[model samples]
Target: MSLSKANKSAYFAWLKHPGHYLFFKIFIWFWLTIIGTVAALVFLSNITAINAVSNEPLYGPMKKNLIYTAKSIERSAVKHKRTLSEVLVHPRLSKRKLLYLSAAQSDDSLSNKEVPESIDLSLLNFTQNMSPQIIFTEKYQAFGPVNIKVPEGSFYLYEIDINHQPPLIMRFKLMPNWMKIVIAIVASLILSFVFSRNLIAPINSLKKAAIKLSAGNLSARADISVNRKDELGILGRDFNSMANQLELLISSQKRLLADISHELRSPLTRLKMATGLAQMQANDASQSYLLRIEKEANQLDKMIADVLQVSRLEAKSQALSLQKQSLQIIVDHVINDAQFEAKQNNKQLNIVGAVDVNINCDESLIASALENLLRNAIKYANNTISITLKHADAIYIEICDDGSGVPNEQLGKLCEPFFRQSDARDRVSGGTGLGLAIAKNAITAHGGSLVLSNKEQGGLCANITLPLIKE
Candidate 1:
């Protein structure tokens, strides 16, 4: 996918993810708060104070002790007046394991001793002004004291060298404490995940319930009676209460409308009969007036029937009698009726598809919806009206007309009962303005949608989308 498309997909996927919101909140809360607090304390206690003196040399005390031992060894040698070979077999040499001090020259028999080989022969060339140096190697370390030359007087007396194992502190090496860090991070992640999940679960349930309620499932409720001592528990309770009240209110309204419409039918029937009897006795001039009254009565009856149908569709107790029917046949019938009406207004009606598709729906309700759309389009169409059908993941039927479309601001209100555009269309066409509203309710009852928009080419387009039946 392209970068923009991939980013959009990832964003929508994250929105759908259950823990997405909680992840960031918990991560920030844990790391910035809990981890930061612990890290600060550890740094102050372990790192900051130690760092002040850490750079100082660790071998200073050992060097001083070695110098003291060297002085004592010199005193012992002077008192004994022993040869360099005798010094190698000295009791002090055998007793000390850490410090091995010895004296020797290349020509002397002591030079062949194992202890003297630990010292370098070039140390005998050291001048009085030069300080002794400590040299470290892989095997052993050697320290040669100042003013100590390899040869002195008749023999090499000041060829003093100290060779022993390296100190423990000096052998220190730096290494990362990765195991502790890994354990800390893993523990943080697990704790944060648990915290976020607990925090977000109720909110997610409430969101899903709200979405379902908005989509016409009034029975949808958060139903989260979790034993949480937080704001979310209270909110969930409030949401359930609100849903129940709304369902009750809407149910009452639907019942009232249905009852009123049913009661109005009796009076309307008697009026139609009275108008028919009066028309039989009326004069030619009064006959036109009687016909106008009859037309208005018929319009009112039609409007009442539409209102009743809308109420029935909205009532959750009413179930649809769905059956498999040819969608093409329905479309063709609507087109044939619309064409006759369109001819009266000097408009051409055309169909742009022949694909026969079957759908599971209430056939009469679906037919009524299409007919209402076609009739509305025929009334407003200036010259040409087109009906187009296509199928993809769902079935799409678009009815368009070449006429000045409704104002952009009023398009959304068109589906509302008794809502008409600020124009002469309704007045001239004698529309009760409930046709589109009833059709919308009928389409919604079938789990379909009816959308109205102005085409880019200067006309109004009504698009209906319905879910396809799986065969």
Candidate 2:
């Protein structure tokens, strides 16, 4: 592949990978911070070095002090009739504060072991001009080769004073400031990149696990984080523990619901049989009560079935059997059944727009969800209900009614199981309050969403969005 294509491929791959973007972001931030700090310190150090060099005190009083100390030692030697080298070792002069003495031959050659190894011998060349010259190095400064004449022989006197600058500052001053800054930046980038990766890697794992858990995958875990021995590992372990508890609690709740629903089935079946037998033996006056009992029994049975379905959906016990089906056809089938129900109640049902979209979904679940929503619209609508279908990035099916809209505050709770707007509505509708909940769950199972909102004109509108199958 061409280089550009290869680069594009890698770029796309990085985008597809989890956590790489976060890692890059963190790395960039850390690298910039560290590099900025290093550059600032380098700049400040350069400023200090420049000031120290420009305002150095070595050229004035320090030079005079060296000359004065050398003259005093020379006078002491002449008075004591001792050689210059011998006089240089006298306790009084040798122990002088802030003065270091070294003696050499007049020719600038070392005459004794007085010179320290740290002082470069090449600096003695400054004395050949027969004038006091200052020599600077990383550690200290030397002023010297002042001529000291004695009967024994001519000697050179030198004074060394420590610079008192910090060793690190002195060493840093040896190199160009720009070079040092460049080196510091490079090192910081490398170290920051590694540190950011190590820090964000675990966080990325936790993020992935969290996403999976939120998406109903109970088994997701931060395996990499769990292996670490740091605080992140502790957090990871706690997260896993929480997930485990949640899985157990939800599983138990679903099992309990399913078991209760199953247990009630047998008794409801017996009750229906007994009701049937009673209706056959009862006279005209008792028949009405028996019919009411049968109707209530049927509603109860539906409630139990809805509870079982909710349990199954929550447990993910029912896997979706996906198929490519025409969404228009499914909507039509649901609308036809709903039209008959609307006619019976003297309400009108109409389809406003048409779309021919094929979607990958569980057909039965999608159909059932639509049926529940259409029936809900038929029940609440005062005079007219409308279905609108449109094709966009996904398929949109909107069912609208012309009745009173839900309260804004209570709109969010419409899909919650066993929730009713008011006791009066609950009694009048005789609903199990699980229809919207089941519909929402069923749509979600097929990677679709059901949204309910108040229409601008009047009444509620239920909008369902299903992903379209790509050909």
Candidate 3:
């Protein structure tokens, strides 16, 4: 059967995830194991029962009829050779008898007759070996006395041909039914369901914990099977250790950035003071140089401050001040300021939609992040820029520009600190390359995401998504 795209994708997803893959693997294995074992039991039972029924004692009547007939045929065949052939076509036996007469002489019958081929040749051979005797004596056993009874319909003939003597013939039955064994085996297999559930319960718990961990709940642990001394217990312990280490390392990195940013501020303040002191005694030509030095110093100071803010946001040092605010007011104010700057740079800035909904947010932080996005849009816009906002399950703010989009390879790196798509352009534009990084950190701090993608038509699109507050 052909599968739809969604179904194919879902099947692939199940194979990729460890927990889902493991669950399917165990489920298939358990069912196949039960089926295979039940089938084996049924096969073995059929063999044993067929062998028991095929034993010589069960064919007592057939044995007596065959021996008497065979002795009379032997006695008459000495007078006429055609008598043996005539008697084979119409044997003197019970109405229940159904036998195949062997044409070959008894002296060479065992060597000439090959067993019938079937699906279960071994079992067929076992039953066929239990044919009854035509005559029995202590010194000369007839057809080798055996304990197994043949199945009801199956029969094999034995012929005795001596020198100048007609052939002596006898027949015995073999089994023809095997259904009862199958039904009994299927009934026994139905009771194994409880064992299957017990086997899956621990694995289900691990699957849940794995899914929770993948969804960013780092505290999730596979507590099941941890007490046992088996391989499962080892796996649970290992997973817990890895999660703890990952959490510790990320926490340490954030704390380190915060600490370093705090320490750098003191030296940067002294540098600005030193630059201002040198500017006091400079001549007119030297004053330009001093001003340039001062300008660079101030830019450096701003960059450091922005960097510190980013670290604080990541470390969660600043708590949110969420309050109901007019979305339209915030967007208008940010756009007005950005349009003035766009006009200075020979670019047109406009708003596409007016949003009047009240959203809960940290006004200062969100506004600052929006301003940073606008500035970036203005910086890269060739001639036009636009802003739009909407509220659904979440609030969305999109800032777009008509300039060339960033390279596809560099799109993901845009939010990383100090990541510049073009080093020369970033330097010439007086960009420290931390604007988008800081904006992303701020949005993430408010439980939102800042997405950057290339516009389908042209340029770059920055999307900000924040959850709507429940009233």
Q: Best lDDT goes to which candidate?
A: 2
Q: Of the candidates numbered 2 and 3, which has the greater lDDT value?
A: 2
Each model's number of backbone clashes?
0, 0, 10
Point out the higher-scoring one by lDDT: 1 or 3: 1
Residue-by-residue lDDT tens digits, candidate 3, 111-190: 11223332122222333344553332111223322221121112234422111111221111122234444543455455
Q: What C-alpha lDDT does candidate 1 achieve relative to the native structure? A: 0.69
Model 2 TM-score, all chains together: 0.63
TM-score of each: 0.65, 0.63, 0.60
The C-alpha local distance difference test score for the whole of candidate 2 amounts to 0.76
What lDDT score belongs to each candidate, Candidate 1 first? 0.69, 0.76, 0.64
In the predicted model 2, the residue pairs found to clash are none
Weakest 10 consecutive residues of candidate 3 by summed lDDT: 162-171
Q: For model 2, how does the per-residue alpha-carbon lDDT over 136-254 read when each residue is reduced to its tens digit?
A: 45556556657666565566666656645435555675557668977998899899979987987788678889999875677888766435889888888888899999889877877
* Stretches of model 3 off by over 4 angstroms after superposition: 1-22, 46-225, 228-250
Best by TM-score: 1
lDDT of 1 by residue, 233-283 (tens): 999999999999999998898788789999999999999999999999999
Model 1, clash count?
Answer: 0
